[model samples]
Target: MKSLCRIGHSLHSRGLTFGSSGNISVRLPEGGWIVTPTNVAMGDLDPSQLSLLDDDGKWIDGPKPTKETFLHAAMYGARRDAGAVVHLHSTHSVAVSVLEDIDPADVLPAITAYYVMKVGALRLIPYFPPGDPALGEAVAGFADKHHALLLANHGPVVAGADLRSAQYAAEELEETAKLFLLLQGHKIRPLTASQAAALKQ
Candidate 1:
């Protein structure tokens, strides 16, 4: 719980998310999860206030889970290796998501080696109203194959083997999205498929 609070505060302090604009969750080893509560400011999270849920998404303790609980659960359902999930309405990533020309299949380009290494392939899911069940279903469709995803007109969701990893990848996705937008209309040099593949090796 301390770790989750710390990460939440860090993300909020760094301007990655503010107010109640994001949600985070970490899977428990004993078959459940600890998730941020709905409508709580990330900067003001209390460890004890975090929601606890059973494997089946039953509320066991703490405050009510974020309205987007289904999205986190969907990722866990699809990826056995996922230990933590980070969803943020970050500025740059949301900006990139709303761009019409960007390919939905691969929202961001392999603009940097670190982006390639940390974020890998970023799938873009179409827009769905906040807390919409359809959003969870869309995320589940590709959660197992991709660690990072961009929600159309929304933001980014990233899953990792642990909290720190997920946070780092989320940050990377935001930064890369910023770079992608900054370089728009410029003759930018993106890494080739071979180069990106080599980085994954």
Candidate 2:
């Protein structure tokens, strides 16, 4: 709980997320999970107020889970190795999402080695109204193959082996998105598929 609060606050304070526009969750070893409460600003999350849910997704304690609980569950269900999930309505990432002509298969180009190594290929998920159950279904379908997804006209959702890893990857995604937007209309050099694959090794 302390770790969750600390990371959430850090992300919020750093402007990676704002207001009550994002949600985060960490899977528990004993089969349930802990998530930020609905409509609570990440910067203001009270450890004691974090919501708890059983493996089946039923609320077990604390406040109500974020309305996007199903989305978190879907990621967890799809990726056995996913230990944490971070979803944020970050400015640059959201801006990239709404832009037309970006390849949906790889929304952000591999502009930096860290971006390639940490974030990999970012799949773009078509927009769905926030908290819609269908969003969960869509994410689940690709969660196993991709660690990160950009929701069209929405934002980014990233899953990692743990919370800090997830947080770092999310930050990398945001930075890369910013770079992508800034380089628009300029001849930019992005890592090629072969170069990115070599970095993955």
Candidate 3:
């Protein structure tokens, strides 16, 4: 959580997120995980304010786990390759959530080879209330197929090889979301399935 606290503060300071609108977690080197607490100001989150939880969502120690513990737990469960989770209420990415027709199967276009190789397919999960278990379940359901997902009318959650990778992926998600919005009114000549597949390889 100390790590997330620092990252959250940095993100907030840089205007990537604000208030208590985002949460981050990292699997500890030894075991367990450290996560940000719910509704706490990112700028004020000290190590003391963070939560440590076991893989099963059990509080192993430290402050109470974030209300979104289940969501992080589900990520850890579904993606054994994941060592960290980052959920952010970034401005542009959340903006992508309100569109009525965002495709869940392959929401993000391979507008660039970098997006294709780094993020693969970005999915859009349906709207679930804040702290809802169904949100976790939905993410878990698509874990194997995506590295990043846009939560409807909410934000984005990304799971990656490590905390650094998760953070990078979250930033990439926001950047792509902004691109997606900018190109909204235009005809997009995005990469086709075959181009995406070839680039991914």
Clashing residue pairs for model 1? none
1-201 per-residue lDDT for model 3 (tens digits): 457778878888888878877888888877788888777867778887788887677887777767888878888888888899988889998998887787777777778777776678888889999888989899899887787888888888889998888988888778888898999889999888999889867
Write model 1 residue lDDT over 52-148, tens digit each, in one string.
9988677899998999998898889998999999999999999999988988888889999999988998999999999899999999999989988
- Among residues 3 or more apart in sequence or in different chains, the pairs in candidate 3 whose N, CA or C atoms overlap within 3 Å are none
C-alpha lDDT (0 to 100) for residue 180 of candidate 1 = 90
lDDT (0 to 1) per candidate: 0.92, 0.92, 0.83
| lDDT for 187 (candidate 2) | 97
Q: Local error of candidate 1 at 160, Å?
A: 0.2
Put down candidate 2 lDDT per residue, 115-154, tens digits, no spaces.
9988999999999997799999999999999989999988
Candidate 3 ranges with C-alpha deviation above 4 Å: none
For TM-score, candidate 1 versus 3, the one ahead is 1
Weakest 10 consecutive residues, lDDT, candidate 1?
A: 55-64
In model 3, which range of ten residues has the least summed lDDT? 1-10
lDDT of 2: 0.92
Give TM per candidate: 0.98, 0.98, 0.92
Minimal lDDT window, size 10, model 2: 53-62
Q: TM-score ranking from best to worst?
A: 1, 2, 3
